[model samples]
Every structure is written in structure tokens, then in C-alpha cells.
Target chain A: MIILNILFAIAWMALNNAYTPVDFVAGLLFGFLVIIVSRRVLTREPLSLQSWFTFSARRNYPLLVWRWAAFIVFGFWSIVKANIVMARIVLSPQLRLQPGIIAIPLDITSEIGITILSNLITLTPGTVALDVSSDRKTLYLHAMDARDPDALRRETKQEFERRVMELLP
Target chain B: MSLLEIVTLALTALGVLFIFLSSVGLIRLPDVYTRVHASGKSATLGVVGVLLGVAVYYVDLRVALEMLALIVFFFITAPVAAHMLDRAAYLTGVKPVAGTAPDDLEGAYNRETRSLR
Candidate 1:
């Protein structure tokens, strides 16, 4: 596991008493070599190191963490902006909101992914996910301002949904 | 006393202001759906602002990191709670304001079966 490798590297660094970026990287390489050589011995199975490497590469776990961090930051900023929208709607004299229920189609296939996307959408001021379709292809949400459903659909797909897919995929 | 302290105080004030605005929104908004929008979204940011202020006030790496984790956890959970409220309110046939329109979800839900078409 990635965490295991990092832990092994940290242990190496701790033992060596050399706390430097270069030293940490060297320790990581040494730890990875140990894993590569002893993976089969540890697992007691005929495991190919190359296959494991490919799996980690495909999964991109480290990158996934970074993307999630980025998404959280971006999500916070968007929520702040959405709050401003709410402030405007609430404080305005005329109250010109067009609240309605509209179903936006789903690109995320996994249940977890859809739920995360729905949660993020619900956090936005104008949108709250009401329900998902039986087939799971559509997500019906209540929007406080639905002047242009098409534009909202495109924005959701581009902004929130894309980040969620990248983080989950 | 310091720059970080100033930032912390400013963030706390902003957070309290957001909380005040959310309450005002709750009072001014017309119906259930719009009211939820005002309360749920603004209140979340308000809490986040206050939490961030606390994190800044500590000025320690561990504290900051833990606070960041807490903020993310709060963000994820707060929306879920709000979503549950909105979903429950809608399913129970709570009516919206007069001008609410273009409801694509009108026929999709079979309330008797509580399933979507």
C-alpha cells in the first residue's frame, strides 16, 4: 500500500538521523526497493512487482489525494460565492427568485460518487438534490433560481460534477 | 495584538455577520424551499468562517491541520443534514410559492409508491 511505503520511508529516515528532502526521497527509494523485492515473500503468492506498479499507477492514489484537497478548497470558495448569492436574494427588496424542481442528468455511475456530487450540489445556495432517478441516470434537485436550466446544467457539469468525477475516478 | 490575530478577529466577525444574515433570510424568505436555501447555505459558510477563525487563532501546525479536517468534515455533514431536511420536506408534499414553475420532476415521482419513474 502507498501508506505502507511512505511509513517505511519515514522509518528509514528516522533511523538514519538525516532529516532532509533528499534524504527522505532516498529513503523512499530504498523502501520501495525492499517492497519490490520482498512483495511475493510477504504475500506468500506469485505476485509480479510490475503488475502491482501498474495497478498503483492506474489508480493514482497520491494524485487522488491532491485532487480531493484541491476540490475541498475550490468547494469552499464556491460555497462562499453561493452564500453571497443567498445574501443577495434574501436582502433584495423585490424577491425575484424562480424556485423549481429540475432534474439534471448524472455522469457519475458509482453510488458513492453520485452521493458526493449530490451533497456538494446541496451545499450550493440555489440547488438542493431532492432525489435520484430509479435508473440512476438523472438527479432531480430543487433550484432556488432556475432562470436558465440549461446554463445551470452546463455549469454543474463543468464545475462541481467534473471535480467530483476526477476525485472519485 | 498581531496580524494573525487581526485576521482571526475579522473572520470571526464575518462569521457572526453571516449567521445574522442567515437568520434574517429565514425570516424574509417566503416558503419552505427558499427558506431552506437561505438558512442551509449561509449557515454553513457562517460556521466555516468561525471554525477557520479558531484555526487561525491557534497558529499551530497540528491545530491548523486538525481544524482543516474538521472544516471538511463539517462541510460534508452539514449539507447532508440540510439535504435530508429538504428531501423530507418535499416528500411530505410541502407547497412552494406561487411562481415556482417548470417542474420537470412533477410526474417523475410516484408519491404513492415513493419511487421514481
Candidate 2:
């Protein structure tokens, strides 16, 4: 493979009628592509390095980038909405509130995913991620006003958790 | 003024408003945990808004990237800080206000064993 790459690079430089460093680097890149393609064609099998170096994380980089943009936009709008809600709660003349910790079960099992979910929860209005259960099956969150626990749980799962799962997983 | 200036001003105002509201929540809320909610969430958003406003006003790629980096850093750090603060407050026996229901972790701690039950 090394010899093939070098030979292809030399051929590329000859064809281009240039032997400069930049042309050599470009030839090196072109050689890599030629080797990859010829290997696939000659062996009738996928490249060996493909299996080893294929990162699932990188497979959808463009998609992830777009989704990340969406997440940021959504997060910004949610922040605005949360701010308004919090302001209402704080500025209310009655001081009517129903604050408590609600245990939300986990669907995102990865450590990074859970961390993100918790961070997002804490940053959103009305909710603070207090602690993760010892078993890691549950996330305990404190809400400033969870008048209807079931609805809150549903909203969390549908909105925050779902989007986070899509993003991380 | 131009539309961009108007939008930047609006964003700045909103950001400052959220920051101010955070202080209000800090003063009005009942306990340490709730106060963490106010400071953690509102303050982070407020700073983001303010940074975004500035970013828009400048309209430069470098400025936008810097603002984005700042926002991400704030997002990651704020919650961890809030969690640590709440955890410390809880371990130190800071109780919630009167009639704050659903104390599920009430018996989850085993002080003698020095571990969570």
C-alpha cells in the first residue's frame, strides 16, 4: 500500500507537470484516493481501514451540524419563554407556587447524554436538576411550580429529552 | 435608527430584563434550591442574550464565533455550578419552606452509614 501510494503520487506530479511541495501534497492526497478506489476495485471488498476508522459520530457530521443549529435556535427561544414564565412567577402578586422535587426516569443512558439533559433542564425555566439517583435510572429535578407532575413529565420527555436524545444519540 | 440597531437594542433590553428578574427571584424565592434555579437559569440566558445582541451589532464572523463560544461555556458550566450549590445546601440541612411537598429523598440518606439509601 505504501509503495502504491508513492507511485501514484509520482504519477500525479508527472501528469501535472509540477514538482513543487504544494503539488506534491496534492498528489499525496490524490494518491490516497487512487489507492482507496483501486483497492476496492481489485479486492471486490470494502477497504480494511474503513471498518476500523469509521466513526459513527462523524458519519453524519453535516446532519449533526444542522441539527445542532436547530437545537441552538430552539434553546434560545426556550430560554426566552422560560424567562417570561419565571418573571411571571416571581412578579406575581400572590406568590402562588407549588415547588417540589420530581423524579424523572431516564431514557438517555449515555453519561454525556444524561449530562446534557441535566444541564438543559437546569438552564430551562422552572426546573433545576438536583441529583441523579445512585442507580442512574432516575434524575431528580426540582421545579419551582409543578402543579401537574404528569404533564410536566410528559412535556420534559417530549420536548427536552427527545431533542437531546436526537442530538446526542 | 436602522432595523439592525433596533433589534440589537431589543435583545439587549431582554437580556438585561432576565438578569434583573434573576435577582428578583433570588430575593423572593423560598429556599437555597429555588434560588439556584433563579440564578442558574436566568443569569445564563441573560448573558447569552446580551452577548447575542452584541454579536448582531458587530456582524463579524470572529465576533460571532467568540460570542458562541462564550454561550456554550456558560451553558455547560452554569448547571454544574447550580448542582454543586444545591447539593451542598441540601447536605448542610437547608430545609425547604413550609408546605413544600414531595420530599422523596427524606429517607434516602443513611447518615450512620454515611451513604445514600
Q: Best DockQ goes to which candidate? A: 1
Q: Candidate 2, after superposition: displacement of residue A135 in Å?
A: 2.7
Off by over 4 Å in 1: A1-58, A61-66
Across residues B42-83, which tens digit of lDDT does each residue of candidate 1 receive?
988888889889989998767877888888788778777777
Candidate 2 lDDT over B29-111, as tens digits, reads 88887888888888887898899999999988779889989988988998999988976677677897776667666766555
Residue A125 of model 2, lDDT score: 74
lDDT of 1 by residue, A1-169 (tens): 4676788889988999888767878887788677666655554544675655554432444455567679877877779888998888778898787888887888889999998998889887589887788889998888998888888889888988888988664
By TM-score, the best candidate is 1
For A109-130, candidate 2 gives per-residue lDDT tens digits of: 8899899899888878788888
The docking category that best describes candidate 1 is medium
Which residue pairs clash in candidate 2? none
Global fold similarity of model 2 (TM-score): 0.73
